[model samples]
Target: MRLDKFLKVSRLIKRRTLAKEVCDQGRVSVNGKPAKAGTNVAVGDEISIRFGQKTVTARVEAIRESVKKEDAGQMFTIVKEEPTVEEEQASSNL
Candidate 1:
């Protein structure tokens, strides 16, 4: 699935246009490489997303065209989330 579409279908970004903008700005990476909105993604790929003061890192466990809100979290496994600048800076200083 395309990165933007997957992000939307999986309920990560909440909107398709925002996903594209995020990807375009190079704030989204797939498996450690920068990815664009049209980048292809598959099961097991790691995704790192930067939105505002939060950074969410997850692994795509499964992909679906549509999923209920209750099942949204199941589509990907959140491995890490450094949601604050202070925490990120602290970690970076390690």
Candidate 2:
């Protein structure tokens, strides 16, 4: 599945267009390499997305064309969630 589609169907970004925009801006990476909206994703691929001061990493567990809201969480497993270095520094200073 496409990266943008997967992000939407998995409820990672909430919307496909936003996911694409994020990806296009180089905020999304797959397997440690920068990825685009049309990038192909497969099971077990690690995806990291930067959202402002926080970064979220998830491993693709399953891929489907569509899923119920209740089942969306089953598609990916969050492996790591951490704030960026700048965020950590700001928090430490506060």
The candidate that achieves the highest lDDT relative to the unseen native structure: 2
Candidate 2 lDDT trough over 10 residues, lowest sum:
83-92
lDDT of each: 0.93, 0.97
User: How close is each model in CA RMSD to the real structure?
Assistant: 3.0, 1.1
Instruction: Put down candidate 1 lDDT per residue, 1-94, tens digits, no spaces.
Output: 9999999999999999999999999999999999999999999999999877888899999989889989989999999987667667877999
In angstroms, the error of model 1 at 80 is 0.6
Model 1: CA > 4 A from native: 83-94
Q: Give the alpha carbon lDDT tens digit for every residue of 37-88 in model 2.
A: 9999999999999999899999999999999999999999999999987899
How far out, in Å, is residue 59 in model 2? 0.4
Lowest summed lDDT window (length 10), candidate 1: 82-91
